[model samples]
Structures are given as structure tokens and as C-alpha cells.
Target: MTQTVSIADLMSLSGVTFGTSGARGLVSAMTDRICFAYTCGFLQHLENIGQFAPGSHVAIAGDLRPSSSRIMAACAAAIHHKGGHVDFCGFVPSPAVAAYGFARGIASLMVTGSHIPDDRNGIKFNRNDGEVLKSDELGIRAQNITLPDLFDDEDMLGEPTPLGPLIDVATAYVARYVDAFGTEALRGLRLGIYEHSAVGRDILVRLVEQLGGEAYRLGRSETFIPVDTEAVRPEDQALARQWTSELNLDAILSTDGDSDRPLLADESGTWIRGDILGILCARALGIKAVATPVSCNSAAELSGLFDTVSRTRIGSPFVIEAMNNLINAGQVTVCGYEANGGFLLGAEVRLENTRLSALPTRDAVLPILAALVDARRQDVSLSMLQRQLPARYTFSERLQNYPTAQSRALIAHLEAGSEAEILARLTATFGGIAGEVDGIDLTDGLRIHFAGGDIIHLRPSGNAPELRCYTESDTSERSVANNAKALEVVRDLVIG
Candidate 1:
């Protein structure tokens, strides 16, 4: 007789841990059993709300991890057993799943841990329109799920359906880039791509070549490497330096695991933060209306290029919400994305005739493509273009180990205090107050603005146990330093 795992035991699996972004844990901890039950529950909830129509077709995609395929199969099987037709997209970027969902008029399930380790895996669910919200997750969890036996081999397995011929999604995506800025604009530029483990590697190389620019591919990794564009450690810097030296390249570009986050390196071999890239991309696109996360660097507004600036809570879902509102209200023509520098074009804001209608999710291809074209058009280097932007320092740091309850309480306490009194108290303790912005935003988290273009936004990771604190300023050095100091002050008050 095969042993059965209890629901409590399944939930204890390592993959069950929630992060600020999504659910993620080790594959062993997130067993096939857990995936099936969670998927069943999620689908049932969709059925209840009429989100999952009878015979509705859904798209499934995964990353390059060894376990991704298995998890994708498991989730697809669950959907199939429930009478939903599955259109498998195979291994692709996270945003591609979102784009497919929007384009094909079906919901999407992406199996990826994003920038996490190879041993870890997670799932991101998108409705027919976009990513599922927190409220949706709550509804799914409340649904009654009949957990299947882990060892019940016959009943648990579903028919294996092969995905049709590999779709050249990258080709379609590249065309969108060309449409945004003419191909003639990027002529005669030399670009390098660090393929590593990113799914967008070949696509990025092809994009540059098609644009009439010389392109080189480097640093291809065999193992599933997790690359975080926002937090580049010394090792990543070293690798980038070696690639620059060997390729004699003008710029180096790459993306994280699923290619939703973009990474860029200057000729000098220094990695540019995502927030800085967002500001630069906005300038290159020449858009006056913009919306970004509160955690983003304040340099966006300091550029003096934008006519309307709106700040939302972290996460693309929230950013997309703001973008949709702007589109509906006719306040902006374009939307800007800064979650690690990957910009979502017309698709993000959903324009009818623009190049973005083809893709409505975050993509690493567009910003780099546009920026390269801009550089060639102006006859300037990538770094030179970045330097032309306004000088502002922005720094971000996180305090781990703070309980969710405690973090919320601390934000509530800060908000309840008078703005003047709180500023004076913080100034007295941390030195002097530069400025202050009153009110708390519960949409994503708590964001407090200080005078002189410095900002501190505090929130618990929706998917994890850690707390995230984002800071920004005018100079790079000051931004990094201030972020450290601000995190220290906040940590003391919250934990102590």
C-alpha cells in the first residue's frame, strides 16, 4: 500500500513559503502533490467566479529549470482533468505567458521561480487580461479542494500533450521593438549579450542583428543561474568585466531567469540599477506621462521630462493597475516600468494601434533595443546618454526577519504620528530631516518621501516573510549610503 501525505504535510513542503511577490520554495518541498491540489483549488475558485469558463482554453509556460517542466506538466494535467483545454507554450519568458494569455484570449500559468535558485520553483497565474490579484489568491485559498493521493499513480496522471512547433515569440516581440523605433536608428552599434540561463538570450542577439547592429553572445551558463538585475554582487560584476574585455563591446545586456527583469552594463563594466534604467528609457522614449512604483528611484521626476507622474505600490500587477487607469482616463500616452529595468511597452498600457498591443507584459527586449537605437541615432555611447540625465541618488535595502504583523504595526505607528513631529523626531535621531510626505498608501505598502529627492518606502513582501525598504537620492554614493542608514533606523524602531 502506498503511503498518503496529509494536506498539513504538503503545505509544510519548502515550496509553500510565500514571498512578497509570489509563492516559492524548493522543488522537493513543493511536491507534485502540492502543485496538483493548489492548482485544483485555484481552478475551482476560478470556476466559481466564472473566470474559468467551461471548455476554456489556457496557456502554460515554464523556464529552463530541470523541475520546471515537471511542475508545468503537473499543473497542466490538473487543468486538463478539470475540462480546460491546455495550450502549452513550452519554455519561455514569464511575460510571454502573460502576452499569450492576452493575445489568445485565455488565462495563463507560468512555472518559474524567476531569479531564485534552480532548486526552487513557483507559479504565476494570469487571468485572460493580466496577472491574478491578491484578492484572487484569497478566493482560491478559500475554495474546497480534494487533495489527491501522492502515490495514486493511475488516477493522478493525465494525458501528455505535446506543445506545437516552437513558436518564434521573440520574433514577434522584436518586430514590436522595430515598430516603436525604426530599424535604421540602431545601425552600426556593437552590442554584447550575456546569455547565461535567461530564455531571452537568443532573441536579444537576433534583435540587435536585425536592427543592423553588430552583436556578440557571451557567458552562456550550463546550470540554471539566478541573476537579479537590481542586486548585482561582486561576482556578477567580475563576469561582466571579463565579457566586456573579451568582446570589446559597447554595452552588455541580460535578463533574469524568466527574462522579465533586465540587466545592463556600461563600457566601463559597471552594472546600472533598474530604476536608473527606467528613467533613461523614459527619456529615450520621450514620454511626458509616466507611472512607476513608489520603491523606484526619485530621479524619474527629477528628469523634468515628464508632465504627469504617478506612483503605485511595488509589483507589476499594481503598476499595471495604474497604467490601466491612466489609459482609461486619457491622462497618459505611454506607461513606464522599472521593476529591474525591464520596460513594458504599448502592451502594458494597452494602446489600440501602437507597437505595444502585441505584448502587454514586461519584456527585456524593448528598453535595450530602444536605447541602442537612441544611442546610434545620437552618435553617443550608452554611458554618455545615461550621464546626460539628472543627477539623483537612490538607494534600497531590506530588513529580513521582521514578522508581518510587526512590520504592519510599525508602519501604522509612523503614520499615526504627526508629519512635523515625526520628521522632527527622525531628524533628531538620524541627524536632520530633509523633507517629508504625509499619508500612508495601503495599495502596496507605506511610502514616505523626504525632502531633497530622497524617499523611503516600507512594506512586507507579499510572498515572503522579509520586509523591503527602498531609498533614493541624487548621487550613486549618497543613494547607497542613505539607503543603508535609513534601513538601520527603521530596523531599530521596528524590531527593537
Candidate 2:
């Protein structure tokens, strides 16, 4: 008799754990059996919740990572074995598959690690309504799922079996924009797309052309590139400047591997922080209420633009939950965004004769297109539009491979003392730049406000093994300088 394996068993044996957005683990640790078990477990949980039925369809997609296809095939097989049909969305953006699934009122799964290194991969699950929240993850973990040992061998699933997408998700996603904003919405803009293996690369270029913009395609890589929007690499910054100067583009747009987190650069090739981009996009759409994570720049409040601003932990599901709460409270025109520049529309919106349906998941194209169209309509440069907001600037960086326990310990040490005591300790460790502690917030992490009007937030990354630091200041230069100094101080503290 073949023995059955439970989801918890697989998770324990393979060390695959749920992160900020999904179940992520190293590719080597995520064997075909593990992926299959997880997928089956997710489906079982959905069925229990009345979200899945026999012969129901599940949309699936993946990124450009080398292992994505193999893992995706395993997921497909699991769905097939569970009596569900598959709508293979192919290599599309995470939002593309999600939007398609939600429209058809079916569950979906995406195989990608987002901005993480190619060695790691993840599976993001979505319900027919929206993204699976923390509660859903808990339920999925509690599910009693079983799979046979036939999926244990790695060699059995070494090669990818290409699956055709049932629907043209790319076209539908593009139409969601062009129809709302019109084909000539960006007519005078010259945009450059840094297409470095993002699944949405070609789609983004085509969208720009369809919107009557002059599209200059740049940086098409056959290999996967882990482009973290929150922690923009120094080399990518230089490349943006080079591309902008050489092409004389009005703006440059790109996204992380899965195309959920956006990267937007001004005409000068200076990349704008994701939080600031979120603020601009919200204001562009005339959003009255907003939900964002605590790590975001406080300019959303400082600008006095939105009627309500709710801050949650550093994750989309948290933000989405908060947004839903606002909606339930009778506040319409609700939206949410992450510091990674992914925007979510919490309600249906109509612009002129076009109506855009709600997509309450992280989306790169919406924010990128909205910001560009807003700038064009205002007849101002993207930089000028940014300047119109409150002068608060923020910078973020991560200490790679830092242990989460160590990060928590350091924060706990400071948080245990009084304000003056904590200030003394911070000044001693971080040098005089720490100044005096004006206030401290432990909402999602340790966020410190200094008398000198600078803010430093330290938190362990929820998705990867790293310690992330965010700094805000009255000026852009100071924010950048303080960010670098804070990371250096933390590195020295950990090493020394």
C-alpha cells in the first residue's frame, strides 16, 4: 500500500515555510513531491471553504526563473490529480494570472520568487475573490492533504512540459489600462522599458505603444535577473541614468521578476522610491482613502492628500485587509500600495467612459501607467510631480543573509529601555547620527524618530534572510546618506 504524506510533513521535511507573500524555499529543497503536496493541500483547503469544486479551473503562471517551469508543471499535475482542470497562463506577470482568475471566479497559483535570487522560488496562492490572507494561510496549513511517493524523485520532473494558456491574459490586462486611459493617454511621452527578463516585458512595451507612447525597449536579458524594487542596486541606478541620457526618454519603467513590484525612474534616470511612487499614483487616481504598510514614507499623511491613511505591517495581505476594513466602514474609493510600488484598487473605478474592475492584489502596471498618464495630463515632468508632494524622502536597504533572531534581539534590546535610555544606546551604537529619540513605534518593526527629524526603521525581511532598514528625512540627500550610514552601523555592530 502506498503511504500518504501530509502538507505539514512535507513542510517539516523540506524546510519550506510561509513568508510575507507566499510559501518560499530553496529550489533544491522544493522537490516535485513537496510542490505537489503543497498545491494539493491548498486545493483541499479551498474545497473545504467552498472555493473549489470538482472539475473547477485553476489559473497558473510563473516567472523567468530556470526552475519555475518544472515547479509549475508539478503544480499542474497536482491540480489534475485533484480533479480540477488547469488554465495555464504561461509565463505571465503574477498580476496577470491573478486578475484573470479573479475575473473568472476561480482560484489561482503563481510560481515565482518575485525579487529574490533565482536559487529560491515560491508559490503565491489566490482565492477567487483576491489574495489569500494570513487567515487563509493558517487554514491551508491546517488542511489534511495527502500525496503518494511517486512524486518523490527529482529526475521524474526535471524537464518542463510546456502548457498553453487557455486565455490571453496579457491582452486583457493591457485592455484594462488602454480602455480606461485611452490609446493617446500617453501620446507625448517617450518611455524606456528596462526589460530584464520580467515576464511582463513584452506586454509592457506593447502597452506603451498601444497607448500612443514612443517606446524604447532596453535591457532584454535571456537569463533571470532578480530586480528588487525596494533595494535598488547601485549598478541598476547607473544603468537608469545611462539609458535616460542615451535615449532621452521621458520616463523609464520596469518591474521585478514577477512584475508585481514596479521600478519607475524619472527622465534624469534617478529612480524614485517605491513609497513615493505609490503616493503619486494614489493622488493621480484621486483616491480618497489609502492603506499602506508602516515602512512606507509618511508623506501620505504629511501631504494631507488622502482622507484616511491606515498603516499595517509590511505585506500586501495586511494592507488589503486594512483596505477592506475601510470599505466596510463605508469609505469608498479605497486603494492600497506597498513600499515596493505595487498598487491595488479596492473598488471599481470609472474614468470618462471606461470602467476598470477592481484588482485587490499587488500590481506593477497599474501604478506605472497611472503615474505616467498623470504626469502627461498635468503637463509636468515626473520629477516636478514628485516635488509637488511633501519634501519627506525615504531610502531603504537590506543587510543580506542576516539572521532574523539577531535582528529581533537588537531591536528588543533598544525597545526594553525608556526613551532616554534607548536614545543613549542608539547614539552610542549608531554614532551621533542617531541623535535623540523623538518617538518610537513598534507596529511592524522598530521605527525610531530622532530629534534631528530623521527616521530609521529596522526590521527582518519577511521574504528573505536579511535585515531591512528604512530611513526618512526632510531632504533626499540626507535620507540617502542616513540610510547608508545606518546599514554600515548595523553591519559593524553585527560583525564587531
Candidate 3:
């Protein structure tokens, strides 16, 4: 019999902990043993919950990060040791692996750090049904998992070579959209794909071509690139403009490292905010109910496009849970998305004989494809379709290496006193441009609403040591300016 181990002890030794997205930590901190232990713990939890059985198949995939392969191998070893077989999905998007595995009622895992820097990495676990929720995390942590050191002298792991890919998950994912939307869904649309280092870069291009659109692959990189859809780099913005003029493209599309959160630009190279993209996607699919995180823009509520809108904390699992609740309440057409443009379909719907199955997880492809298709059907530019929404814009940025504890301290200080006192304290840094503090929402973070409809929300990134600030205004310029101002103030506060 295998020696039993404490899951909490392994986490403490590895310094890896659960975040809003997954279990993330520095690469140096995540040794092979740590990864193996965590995998075993996750498996043991699933077994306890009857989600897994001995000799069952567990699919795995990874992103383009250098350390991903090694970590994936360790996870494969863990699966084999736990009496499960590994069906390597190769390098693919997180959603693709999840889609294939969830369809077969099997578990899956993705080794990725998302848009975080190369120094960090993470593992996202998915149950047979969908993403692992907070309760699942607790169950995993509570499992007693033991690991024996195979290499006693050196810090290394047993090499558990993964089996070959069982099937082409990428192709299957592509077929999902092409079959639903038809082969000529995006016919005559010229699109640019910022390949970068996203795992789904090639698949995205293939999908465009399969839909009868022209795809121009740009910015392909051999090295891992951290492309945060939330905080797009200045160079990327400039490149989108240059590409638009040169290619005369209808739009530019891309995603982060794992390709779950999308970055979409209009014909003029203007990047549309992800929440706006979510609204457009829902409208395109004719969804009647939408579930999104509190960090998303209020445009969804103001648009009146959906019969029901539910707001949850900032995470896919929360959105999925909310969407499931709506579905259980007898809503046939339900969907969910994040501010990063990751969409989730919660129900099977038929549109003129095209039936789409529910995919209740963050997916970059669905939103990008939906937005482009919607624009084509309307015979309008992507920018024009965006203009139909309410006149609200959002901007976000982050201060890297900022401690989460410090962020909480600052929030506690600001939220400590009465409304008048809080106003005086905040106005000292923000000035009167923010107007008076109308209200404060502490849903997942500290969100402050001003009397003039300007809003500023501050929160620590769940996966990284960073302080994130989000601002919204009636005009795009104001939103952009306020984000910068808020970051500057946050920087000063940290330094002081």
C-alpha cells in the first residue's frame, strides 16, 4: 500500500495555493514532487467524490511555456500512480481539452500560467462535469495524499511519459463551431490573428479558414509571451493599427497564453473591451440569460438585451454556477462570460436547425467567432456593432509585484470610516474628477461608484502578486484617463 500524505503539507512545502483561477505559484517553487503531490491530491479528492475511478482516462493538455512539458509529465506520472491512464491532448487551449473531456464525462487538466510571466506557472483542474469549484478545491486540499521520493539525493520526479494524443481535440473544437454556424458562417470576412504564443493560435486560424474567412497570422513567437487581454500592451495596440491599415482586415483576434480570454479589435484596430464582447456574443447567440462577474462593465445591465442578468464574483466557476442556477430555473438560453472575453454557453439551443451544445466554461473561440459572425450577419463593421451598446467604456491596468495583503490593507483603510470621511480620504488622491463617492461595492473587490457615473474598482490579482485597478466612464477617453490616474495613485500609495 502507498504511504498516505497530507495535502496541506505538500501545498505548504511547494508554496502553491489555489487562486480564483487555479493553483498558481512561481516555477521555482513548483518542483516535480509538488506538482505530483497536488495531482495525487486532486485525484484522490475526485475518487472520494465518485468523480473518478481506478483505470479511468484523464486527458491532459498544456500551453507554450517552457516548463509546461515537464509539469505535464509529472502530472501524468501522478495519474498513472493513482491507477488512472493518461490521454495526452498535447499542446492545446484549456477549453479545448475541457470540452473534449467533459463531453466524454472524464476529468481533465491543463498546465498553464495563463498571461502571467514566464517565471510563474499553474495547473487548472476540471471535473467530469465542468470546472472545479471552490468546494472542489476544499475537498482536494482536505485529501490525504502521500508521495515517496524516488530520487533521494536530488530534487527530481519520476518521468511518467505521456501516451500519444487520443484524438485531435483542436479539430473537434473547430467542428463544434463550424457545424453549428455552418461552413460559410464567416464567409467574405478578412481577419487578422495575432498568433503570439497562445496554444490555440493555429486552431483559431484554422477555424477562420474553415468558416470561409481569410486569416492573416501575425506575431508568431517561439518563446512564451504573456499577453494579458485585460491589460493589452501599448505595442500590441499600435501593431493592431498598423496591421489594419496594411491588411485592410475586418478585425484582429487573439488570446492569452492558454487562449481562454480573447483580445478582439475592430476594423479600425480599436480593441473592444471584453465585457462588451460578451454582450455582443450573447446577443448573437440569442441568449435570454447572462451570468457575469462583478468586474464586468454595467453595459450588460443597461442594454436590456437579456431577460435576466446575474453577477457573481470574478471567476469562471462563479459565472458557471450562476448560469447553472438560471438553467435550473427553466431558462432555455443561458450563457456566461468574463470581462476577459471568455464566454460560456449554459444550454443547448437551436438556431434555424443548428443546435449548439452547452459549454459552461471560459472559451476564447466562441466569443471571437460569435462577435465576428454577428457583425457579418448585420453587414456592419465590428466597431459599428459595438456602438449600438450603451455609451459606457472600461479600462484596467495593474501594478506588478504588489502584495495582496497590502492591497487588502489599503482597502480596509479606505472603507473604515463614514461616507464623508471615506470621500475626503479618496478625494485627497483622486481629486474632484471622480465626483463624490456615491457607493462602494465589496463583492469580490473594492468597487467605488461616483455620483457622475464614473467608477473605480481595485483588487489584487488572484493568480499573481499584483494590484489591479479598473475604471469605467461614459466616454472612452475618460475611462482611459481614469485608469492611468488610479494606477498612479495606487503606485504612490504603495511607495509611501
Q: Could you give candidate 2's per-residue lDDT for residues 147-228 as a string of tens digits?
A: 6546434624544444554567889988989999999998988999999989899999999999999999999999988899
Tell me how far the alpha carbon of residue 49 in candidate 2 is from the true structure, in angstroms, after superposition.
1.0
Q: What local distance difference test score does each model get?
A: 0.69, 0.88, 0.89
Per-candidate TM equals 0.84, 0.96, 0.97
* lDDT for residue 328 in candidate 3, whole number 0-100: 88
Task: Assess candidate 1 and give its lDDT.
Answer: 0.69
The whole-model C-alpha lDDT of candidate 3 against the native structure comes to 0.89
RMSD, one per candidate, in order: 4.3, 1.8, 1.7
lDDT of 1 at 26: 69
Q: Give me the runs in candidate 2 sitting further than 4 Å from their true place.
A: 153-166, 417-420, 494-496
Candidate 1: deviation at residue 398, Å? Answer: 3.7
For model 3, the superposed segments whose C-alpha errors exceed 4 Å read 1-4, 151-154, 158-160, 418-420, 494-496
Ten consecutive residues with minimal summed lDDT in candidate 3? 151-160
